[model samples]
Target: MVVNVSNLSPRLRQLGLVAVLFGAIPAGLALMGGGYPFQVGITALIFVTLAVSLNLVTGTAGLLSLGHAGFFGVGAYAAALAATKLHWPFLLTLPLAGIVAAALGVIVALPTMRLISIYFAVATLGVGEMIHVSLLNWVSFTRGPMGIRSIPPIEILGLDLSGVIGGYYVAATVAALAIFAVHRLTHSYYGNALRSLREDDQCSAAMGLNPVRLKIEAFAVSCAIAGMAGAVYAHTASFISPDSFRFEESILILAMIVVGGLGSLPGAVIGAVLLIVLPEVLRGIGDFRMIAVGVFMFLSILFLPKGLLGEASAIGLARRQLGAAWRGDIGAGWK
Candidate 1:
């Protein structure tokens, strides 16, 4: 009577996961009467997208960036400005936000590419602070600390999706697509090149891989995806402030990947969901909710040093689920 999920083929497993994400979970939330739960769901989905994007650069490419939230804020502000000032629609604003963030990412990458280890990390930290300060001080442009207000919600062709249920679906769809894209990129030879860079840039360069170019591309792509998540946040929340995307936010995101196990796509998603949902679930604990979260994080680090799902296990699972496609059983090469 019990189905063995592990025995399912890669395609089947993927379909089941999609069903759970896009179908069962939403249906359950709907049964619970939506409301605040939907808000949490949307927030979790947004963080999921952010975590996956961060995983690409920090986990896969081995670049410890501390300014991810700055890029996220850039995306939100870009989308907000485009929507409020330019009167652009959601469709246009989404891509615009991503493009703007990606452009900034490239600029940051160019100067910081040569820096490595903690030096690069500090550089990103400074850049993130600069972004926060700029947003706080640019009163004329970003409306200073007042933040953007009355931003339109997700509406495609006049269908208003600002309601709880509708917004959850929109967020879920975006998160799903982001996961799919990251999964594809990470499982391919391209991902292999990134891992090479992570292992040793010098050796990778000697192997003819352009470490600088690859890192830049990875960073740009990661930022672009983070920007898209920001667009979703802006539209869904209908408001945003510089305070929302500060250094703490970036650290929270970094913690998600670290807790989930770096270099693992599945781990990133799991970590995002856990960090977002666990605190909410512990809300009954009054002021100690965050303390509980800290304890859980500490225990996780102590017992599960490699993470709840380590990279090695995650890769093995991926290979098993992917089956022929992963092993090139058909001789079509690594697809």
Candidate 2:
């Protein structure tokens, strides 16, 4: 009981911190009781998962993807179709959804390898829109606008997580795992390579890094995470439509990472929570809620250009500079 937490390995400390933070969300929700608040909490957790997954590509690897919603939708429909048509267990369909979406990510990455900057972003946008349209027209498979219905509640280990609090717990758990995985990724050697690829793909290639292969892997991993999030969303809501996964939705997700800090893991979670909560808190504003949200986002970018968490980092950097100066280490740079 008197353990020295500060002495723990960095990895263990990170795991402990993340577990406590995520665990608190559900615990707080449970204490607050259910209803609209409960639903909002669940929604926040879902987006936290999505934003974290998106960070794998956009944040770590610097791949701009306007088509993440497509991957999300793909995973949703994959699991939905599997559950509906094949009568597969919900647990089994989760990975199937990820695999299907990841395969699509790979296919998209193949063509994207040749493109860069806005072209690559545009390509991803096209890919997302294509997926959205295909879902709209593929009535035999997706049922088009009618969407997939009657998706059963998630059942795991003989316990059904169909209820409000149950679903929240499940989503929170998934979000926690996603955060931990992404944290590890951003701190790992592979993650370092991804950051290198993001900064200079050509230079990284010259240094023996395969830019194409790394980019593909990042896309595939990012999409797989998105797919899993979508599958969880589908089951939690018990239904889904093509409308939920759209270009605008993709933009919203992209905004989450930008406002959160492009390469910051905590930034993703913070951005998701703020964006998700702000909308609901402004629901009383009726039609003007989005306008308020847009204004808020505009201000965030204007003042905190590096992002909220990024701004904090900038402050920390300044403090570090001051500290070095105080320690008489500042003059070495000019030498």
TM-score of each: 0.97, 0.88
lDDT of each: 0.91, 0.83
**Candidate 1 segments whose C-alpha is farther than 4 A from its true place:** 329-335
Best by TM-score: 1
Local accuracy of candidate 2 as per-residue lDDT tens digits, 201-248: 999999999999998988898898899888888888889999999999
Q: Give me the displacement of residue 279 in model 2, in angstroms.
A: 0.7
Q: After superposition, how far is residue 303 of candidate 2 from its true place, in Å?
A: 0.6
Runs of candidate 2 exceeding 4 Å displacement = 1-23, 311-335
**lDDT, residue 19, candidate 1:** 94
| Candidate with best lDDT | 1
